[model samples]
Target: MTLTFAAPTPDAIPLHVIDQSNCDAWLAGQGEQVSQWANRNGFTGAAGQTVLIPGSEGSVVMALAGFGTADTRARKRFVLAAAAAALPKGTYKITSGLTGRALEIECFGWLMTGHTFDRYRTQSPSTALLVAPAGIDAKRVEVQANAEALIRDLINTPAQDMGPDALQQATEALATEFGATCKTVLGDDLLSENFPMIHAVGRAAEKAPRLIELNWGTSGPKLTLVGKGVCFDTGGLDLKPAAGMLLMKKDMGGSANVLGLARMIMALNLPLQLRVLIPAVENSVAGNAFRPGDILTSRKGLSVEVNNTDAEGRLVLADALTLADEGNPDLIISMATLTGAARVAVGPDLAPFYTDEETHAAALFKAATEVADPVWRLPFHTPYEAMIEPAYADLDNAPSGGFAGSITAALFLRRFVTQTPYMHFDIYGWQPVAASARPKGGVGQGPRALLEALPDMLDL
Candidate 1:
């Protein structure tokens, strides 16, 4: 909990959650001074509105946060975080207007708002402290917060410090944390392991390309996660404009999110056979870089035509997905910040995923709504399979026409997984602006929803 929460004690200030419907009655019960203070300050119980009441001794007596109306609650996911951020540096206990799932959600959201990535530069630590709300699992909240912080730190780091080698190091460290086993097929060893496409996509980078695998949990349903670890996408030979490259430090966000989700699973001791596969690479340009029109054979033995060198994410992920499928896991899920079209399709707020299973889709959608980690299901769209097929090769790395770019990219990755129930996430992986619990920077999408839906999805 660190500075975000203090140990429960009798001296903590009482924090009340008020809504518009009950404001009048609630105010009357508070007596004259508290009621007048709130009314004079224009605190009418609107969402995110906060008013701190003072005592006769001139010290803080209590705190009040408006939960607004049902409509406001529906529109906003982490409404309480705004109020949490406004509170003074004191330990407070939530005393009213939240319980059960509602209390948990609010507490989790508020805890998330406490996260800050202050690696390269120092930032002020979160000062306001909270007593863990009753009826909520405090440890679970801590686990989720720490996992998210790990993702943010990884993605927010510059490419020089967070390249393929750094990603592999992080994986090994996580494995060590959970007593798991890690094995990496590094550099040209990917060639010996039949990961030709991975090598082709990352061979030009100063940091060698590798496939990082971490395994944990020996006694439950098999869940394999594959993430695209393109640490920096210079767009290879095709090249992105300077503006496009500005946020490329977050290009490995898919891998960061997978690691974050893995942390949650491992720390919570979820009943699952967990396997994480990260094909770590940097899409850099050099004389020996794979160029457009090059045909690279993947680990699955599928020859792919490189129509655009910038589409290297799918190239590396292809080999990794093939390796994951070979393990015959119950499910294979791949996450990638793969295309601009995904950002255009759902913007940065909603995570758009593809899954062929109706049962999994229904569970995931329901869990997403419940957890407020919104996700939309885009179809596998089997009819569009032809778009990725090229005459010269079995598949095209980047299909032409640019229509349904995200769908085509998903379909392209799908070609590598043959036996597992597959799900693919085309995530924007960045928050363009700060909103509620979500800060602006490399953000995680789909992972939280997937965590909630896993029991049902794996039939555990």
Candidate 2:
């Protein structure tokens, strides 16, 4: 929660952004002593390089941050985070080599660099702070940073303390903050409420399974967000190996990102009525756990056959998505960490999304690039729709042959979302390696691009 940006002050350090294109010109302008300093330090304006300049009295006066070439910038994100890591404790201002969208994204990136999940252990506080850049909404960036922190914190927490009840508590607290109406259908009530699939997947666990719904905004288009909130996945009866279970605590990544997006929508007061539906549960093994070959009816009345208990995310999301569709919202978006096939297709860095609408695809891709939140478009592929339709039920939670796993998963959820423009994001929410501002723990995907593309997607 530390402030990552400082207001403009007289003595803020000058941070010049030099790239390979202008490195020599910048060096020549600084004269011999600085030129020698640059050479001795091997400062070639590479992406992570930095140089400190000294004044006549031998006191530090300014700093140089390397921006590299266009290709270099394309290969990475949050480049200024390197400067944030390199610079000593102080305030700084960008003096050259960035403007417009790049500047705005970097400003937000700089703030994200200050985030660290320290709930379990003590961590050092962030040292460097940047002056909020000119000609952009500083408050917007701060709000987004806070929302991002909330997502990471929720996802990073251990499943031991972050079960279904805890997830509901988090949602309730968030609803209270924004004056939204929040409710949860608990335990046997889930069965009474017709969220049978959600209840079936979670009934084995000690913590009760429930559907959590939050409503906000009094006017504008109705936008429903459905997130798969499997707080922890033991992979049910088809259990995962030790390695697979290591990151199971992050199985609820969808809910975390949904909350982050919900926070942003309410904080920004967007022109949309937002409804968030999260089926909070823990997929655990017990004598009564739902098993393979079991058929469960969803809230949409679609019967789903459990082919693999490991594929539980889509089951929980199916019921929640059905409830969302009953509201007949303008747009239906579902986020889930549902398949390893997605990870194999696009790797961990890119978020692969599926939508039948071309306009949504175009707007989301454009906004993703503009915001440096990378997303790839996967197809709904009606040709493969048969994969999810089993003879035993309306849908199969996991299809045979392991072909088009991500697409079939999307197809399964799409059945419940009958009358809305839908977008399904198959996200690998854990960062395998630390990047610019994002750490190696749980992270968010697709929501930032969704936020930026909302206006055009909904024609607002």
- 10 residues in a row with least lDDT, candidate 1: 1-10
Error of 1 at 55 (Å): 2.4
Residue 260 Cα positional deviation in candidate 2, in Å, after optimal superposition? 0.8
TM-score per candidate: 0.97, 0.98
lDDT per residue for candidate 1 within 292-404, as digits (tens), equals: 99998878888999999999999999999998999999999988898899989988888899988899999999988877788999988999999999989999988999899
Each prediction's whole-model lDDT (CA): 0.89, 0.89
Cα lDDT, model 2, residue 123:
72
Over all chains combined, what TM-score does candidate 1 have? 0.97
Q: List candidate 1 segments past 4 Å from native.
A: 1-4
Cα RMSD for predicted model 1: 1.4
For model 2, the stretches where C-alpha displacement exceeds 4 angstroms are 2-4
Q: Write the per-residue lDDT of candidate 2 for residues 16-83, one digit (tens) a residue.
A: 88887789888998899888888899988988788888889987788888887889888889887877
TM-score of 2: 0.98
